[model samples]
Target: MRLRVHTLLFWPHLVAGLLAGLIIGVMSFTGLALAFEHPILERADRETQQVAPPSPGTPRLPVDELIARVRAARPEAQPSAVTEYPDPTRAVTVSTGRTGGVYVNPYTGEVWDWGASGWRAFFHLMEDWHRWLGAQGDNRPVGKAITGASNALFFFLAVTGLYLWWPRKWTWRTLRPSIWFRRGLKGKARDWNWHNVTGFWLLPVLIVLTATGMVISYKGVSDLVFRLAGETPPTAGGPPPGPPIHVPVPPPGSAPLPLEALFVQARKQLPAWENITLRLSGGGAPRGNAPQAGPRPGGNEGKAEARKEGLAPSTFAIRETGGWPLFAATQVFVDPYTAQVLRKDAFADLPAGNRTRRWLRFLHTGEALGLTGQFVAALGCLGGLFLVWTGFCLSWRRFFPAKPGLVSSGDASTSE
Candidate 1:
């Protein structure tokens, strides 16, 4: 029965590896490249983003003035958001859209666009391949579907590979070759040794990476995560509804509070904030009170409604030092004219499921646990590449076994 079961799993595993190995290899290589994307981009953009103060004790310009300078330089560009850093040397980033932005020297109010960086482009390309197989436009969903199915297969491979790798006999002699790489091995023997050892050692990390990837790729799995946590799942591309905030709108023709006032309020809200991002509503004057729900502010529909209703609120997202899970932020919504904070969403106050989802998102990239986690995740991706190579080599040898004296002496022990 054990032999029959092993045969059942072994053949399918081999076939799956044969069919999807190349795609999996692409995913692994791209994932490995993206592991250090944040630090790499930061270092690459340091010259563009960092500026020297003209003199000691030079005070940085106000947030509104920095943005004014950006608008003055690039009149065609509409500023949607501005990120201010605590560091005096760091330039203020005014974003027009996701991944499109300009950096302004805070001390000098000089505006400059984020120039083309090869490193940035390379990482973006890697990300495209990783998530969508480099698909563009409407074909991206198809690519995503392909990658998602392969990721599910990878999870299966990791699980069954564990079972096949387990030793029937409890002895170091029985397990040593599979557990550790043996020296002087050749051809089939070398491939088998590498496949077994790499798979055995990386099983845990591979399972984690693939599992988190599933949650990201499939809505069903994501919903299951929330259901399993005893919380209602959020809608696709949106968060679960939170309490509604009643934002008092100023009358039409009344001037909205200055950006500097909102900036000051955000500082007061999160005293230890390392960075603060103020998102502009881009609507003129206030007309009526509009209720805002969810942690995130200003979606397309919300902005449209706000424009029609003539209600504009300033949203501030603040990141503090020593925050749990590294990426969580506190969101504050303020009346554009009254300057009163309508709602404040802190990471600690999030639902358990939401917190879990955030962790899973970061864990997929190994950022949840900081630099050490990223290193381990990168190593796992590298190990996955080796597994695919050796798996293919072993499968090829299995189907076309050596005949009559073609086999090397080292290959004699390669049989399963």
Candidate 2:
């Protein structure tokens, strides 16, 4: 293929496929493992807290009741947000998303494990290694760079893989033997089928994952995507805070909002909301983002139809405790004026754009339709590991050269 002529013969991609393949393998398996982590954690955890539950058939505690309980339990720690994981049996995770002291609760509220239980620790390590190669320092100086390079290599790999999968030999008979495993080939042949066949089956899902991940991992790649889509870079509004800081003790007269009361009132306002996340009371951390208006027409409902023309203008301001620019589970902001609960991204709420970008991001993570997508993506992850292992075995056998006693697969004896 023209693309194969352009790229596979090149230096970086060939080196990339040969070396970076293992990094891809680790990243894939770790993601897959996390896909199944919730259930695994619950199964391993012991009953640490006693709880009183609603009747058997009664719905799990209303978001209102749950918020009340969590706030009451940990008054010192600010109740930032509540997450109801998709799994029914697993405990609801009330994460600060902080590394040192995040907690997990099963039913009413019970603590899970620290490092030993493998409760997100191992996954986090693999994440660090796969992203940063176990680089020193919390800042992940080396890991960030490696992650960026791997993302570039992955995109290149995907394009080259398409070329490689094509049957360059042409004849069905000749290609059939090559693409399909012969009854029994020893080393290279065995490894080839594992690599080629496994990869071909997982090609679509992995491609989706790789492409979307590339968008997220690389700043330049994402900017290019936005430009291609004709969307402008979002402008930042205020002087950004420098570093993350802990909640500062209030001055003699500084009064913090009563969160419990806020939750009660919020429910009174938006009965439809399933979740709420709050910003922890803190100093030096500007409570929230300044409101960006008119662009996101999402506050207090009731506006005049353009045809009729008679409605009050909607006021726009950042939702109080809204956290920072790109909020990923740390804290999702809720507008103070409209009480319009935030954090409903496009893919989760409804379809957006003609291309599958929205759905594809979901599909990329296998998170499109709740837990089911997560499970499918997990399988893709395992398959990805197998692909990596097989690719390595094939390349190793080819480059290093095995001894004479070690029979090569492409031979008849390999079938055994």
Clashing pairs counted in every model: 0, 9
Best-performing candidate as measured by TM-score: 1
Off by over 4 Å in 1: 54-59, 281-312
Expressed as tens digits, the lDDT of each residue in 57-124 for candidate 2 is 64554444554555566555544434343334544434343532233443454443333346657757
Q: Report every candidate's CA lDDT.
A: 0.79, 0.49
Poorest stretch of ten by lDDT in candidate 1: 286-295
TM-score of 2: 0.63
lDDT of 1: 0.79
Candidate 2 runs further than 4 Å off: 1-13, 38-50, 54-79, 82-94, 97-117, 136-139, 169-172, 178-183, 235-257, 268-273, 283-362, 402-409, 412-416
> What digit string (tens of lDDT, one per residue) describes model 1 on residues 145-216?
999999989999999999899888979988898999999999899999999999999999999999999999
Question: By summed lDDT, which 10 consecutive residues of candidate 2 come out lowest?
Answer: 293-302
